[model samples]
Target: MELESYRYIAIDGPIGAGKTSLAKRLASLWDAQVVLEQPEENPFLADFYRNAGQHAFQTQVFFLLQRIRQLQAPLDPALLEGRFVADFMLEKDMLFAGLTLAGEELALYETLYLQLRPQARLPDLVIHLQAAPEILQARIAERGVAIEEGISLDYLQRLSECYSQFFYHYEGAPVLTVNTEHLDPAHNDADLRTLLQHIEEMRGKRAFLNQGG
Candidate 1:
């Protein structure tokens, strides 16, 4: 497929799902600009991951605000000159919000999000990555982030559910849902190429890239 045909590609997934690796590869192949969500920028992330109930609102709000700031910025030279690949989807913002915030906190966040909705370039295509909760947990352990060390399977399960629910109705753009339980796009070139082929052939509102299919 002609890379120029896809000016903006957004890759989204839960933690340890490998969105960043694929985004980097795609950006290099297309010579496109890359936008990565800086999860480390959330000062409350460590604490929130350890004790979500106590720090959930702060962590969620911090990420929401930071992502909005990044999204609102003008197209950089690389994007203006060529295509762009991003590791996060702005639409996923609400997934985290719903998972992390409570009644009053969520209401406040919704109001703020409405006011600061970004008006920048939108994705021509989105790749929503998925994996089994067990696989996600194992990957998290291998990476060994101190803050994430305490993350339980229960939490990951809930997070995966939230992501699934959010994307179930996502109609903002063309979506390609990839089940990565057995396929590792990061180290598997064949899997990546297969997905690229699917992206090129996609014409529907949603597409699924699964192992059996």
Candidate 2:
């Protein structure tokens, strides 16, 4: 599939794995619009990171609603106009909900998710970026976002596992999984060009790009 042939592209990964940066770079190269998740806009995120048990429901609900609105509004326009690259997949809401919510809270989240999920437009191609937990931790530390200061390696490991499981059975779109431990497409021109070539050459429902070892 050529890069231009994909109208909707979604790039997903665990936190600090650089999905957003790569999405932005790809969008620029393709002259595509970007639909990104703005964690900073979530008022409960910092608190949720500090005390997940206390603020988990609030944080999850806020993100769910925000994602739905973004998908319906800005993303809809871009999809109709031309190509767009998003940093998130709509199913990512459930991934986080499962990680944070429990018991009745989880049940309630599922109910809301079922109601809003059908409204989302599925992506034509999903780019699932992977990296070692240590690499993710280093990137997180280097970025130094205040809310992410409390992120633990254990949490990142679990998140990475969740992402892997989610994409393993993902059937809504063709998936291109790229190991990013040694690949830096966001800043390296050679890496970006190589990745674009790989995207152009993709001809299967599922593929792997393992430059990391």
Candidate 3:
């Protein structure tokens, strides 16, 4: 299948994995609508990063509701009339919930999630970006987002593990797992072309793409 064949595409990974950058590049290449997660818009994000135990629930809930609103509209003929690309997956909200919430908080979160989850639209294809935690941390530091400065290596490791576990059992969409530790598609034309070719050639329910490293 080619980039044009997929109606909805999602690029997902742990923080600092460059999913958003790649998503934007792919959207430009495919002339698709872009849907991005606005972490800066979340009032509790900085606080949550600084003190997860105290602010986890609020931050998670905010993101959950925001994503629900962002993706509620299905990919139908009435929308943009072309493929759409997003930086995050709707169901991954539960992965973060599992990592952050516990006891009564988790119970309440699960209830709310179950109620709102049905309205989400699944993607036609998912591109799962993977990188080592140290590499992710380096990239995070390079980007220098102030709130994200509170993100620890341990937290990134755990999140990367969570993403791996989630996608291992995922069957909702065709998945393309790309090892991006040594790939810089955003800056390298060759890397971008290679990834685009991989997307164009994908024909299985699951595929893997790794280049340069």
Q: Candidate 2 on 1-213: residue-level lDDT in tens?
A: 767789989999999878999989988888888988999999998988888899999999999888788778645544467788899988888998999889999999999999876555678899999898988999999998998888889889999999999999999999999888878899999888878888889987898887844
Task: Write the residue-wise lDDT of candidate 1 on 68-184 in tens digits.
Answer: 877665344333656778899777887888888879998998887777776666777888999989999999999987878878899889988988888888888888999988776
Q: Residue 49 in candidate 2 has what lDDT? A: 80
TM-score of each: 0.92, 0.95, 0.95
Best by lDDT: 3
TM-score of 1: 0.92
Model 1, residue 90: distance off in Å is: 1.6
Q: If ranked by lDDT, best first, what sequence of candidates would result?
A: 3, 2, 1
Whole-model Cα lDDT per candidate? 0.82, 0.87, 0.88
Q: Return whichever of 1 and 3 wins on TM-score.
A: 3
TM-score of 3: 0.95
Candidate 3 lDDT trough over 10 residues, lowest sum: 72-81
